[model samples]
Target: MTDSRFSCVLFDLDGTLVDTAPDLTGALNHVLSQHNLAPFSVQKVRNTVGFGARITIERSFAHYGKTLSEDALDLAHAQFLAHYSENICKNSTLFPGVDTVLEDFKSNGIRMSVCTNKTENLSLDLLEQIGVSHYFSSICGSDTVPNKKPHPDHIFSAINRAGGITEESILIGDSMADVESARAAGIPVIVMRYGYTAIPSDELGADLVLDAFSQIPQALRDLSH
Candidate 1:
């Protein structure tokens, strides 16, 4: 893209920019093992992800045929957090072509930001560890705002932090939450096919759907034209 249709680009961290499933699944399974529950398959976790930590915890318990209580959920959630904090990037990797796409955006002078449901410190830590921290002008995690994805607060907050307004921004994400958030924020969104979404990508209601990150630059270019 020529970086004209949008002044800023907002990204969803987990499934969009990076494949963080390994760390997340590892942490969830670790917590399950502690309670004598069977580990969930990676595919199962992938299908259940894209929400926040609490929903992931609840889904984990439900997957194991266990009921989710507030106390148990809290404990399991903490375990996941603690475990992931130490091993966030153990096997995590950026999706194919992500670096190139990001670099293209940066080279084109498009402002970029991240809005994720992951905790602030964890998101920042992972971004820094993965060598993409310097690309974004602002990174807003769940804790950075009062609401999470599916809510416009994170997207709007990121736009504000990036010094852009809603009319001149776009959200790039891998789930329906991103679509909803962008819709609520009065911006357009593009969804990726390879991200962790609860349902099919076509049903997410994004302005565009891409199968590869490498296609993003061209897609944006087309949009600008």
Candidate 2:
């Protein structure tokens, strides 16, 4: 638990900071209903969301007992974007204790940034809609770089934008993509236990795994010491 090296905290937007499952599920259900497919349960949607928009849509279609053709995929993708865009924050919210943890970091002079697999525009829109856009000094999304997470480019870009490097940063997320990306970038990672992760949180191989967002500040303190 060595945190002295971490001066900046980089977050993954969708599953890490924001509970975007509701809006995402709504959009998916909209598409499903249009195609005469059954809507999925929230738990099912939650389990399928961390992979990014295309994967989410693909999984949603699969769950509805349908395989999307290229044209159908494109149409569903468009509908999802439009639907989610309009309702991005209507049901989306920061995970519990997220604000307290973020404020604690800011109070301690730690810089913060967002590094997500979502498109830059949608990420910003969602962050702003959720009213936490001002907390981060940098926000890098999939479109911001040539490659997305598991590649480390987006994380590095965020670190750079935050005026730091991997040695002075940590990525807090709930997915294997975050863990692997931070590992590739040579940064420590803290994974939240209660987010939309693909596998068990411990299996992500993060430097630290926390059960709650409220525990983050203490976890960071432990790491720093």
TM-score of 1: 0.96
TM-score of each: 0.96, 0.93
Model 1 clash tally? 2
Please report the candidate that would top lDDT against the real structure: 1
Residue-level lDDT for 86 in candidate 1:
97
- TM-score, candidate 2, is 0.93
Writing each residue's lDDT as its tens digit, candidate 2 over 159-223 gives 99988767778889988888889999888899988888658888889999998888877777788
User: Which regions of candidate 2 are displaced past 4 Å?
Assistant: 1-3
Best by TM-score: 1
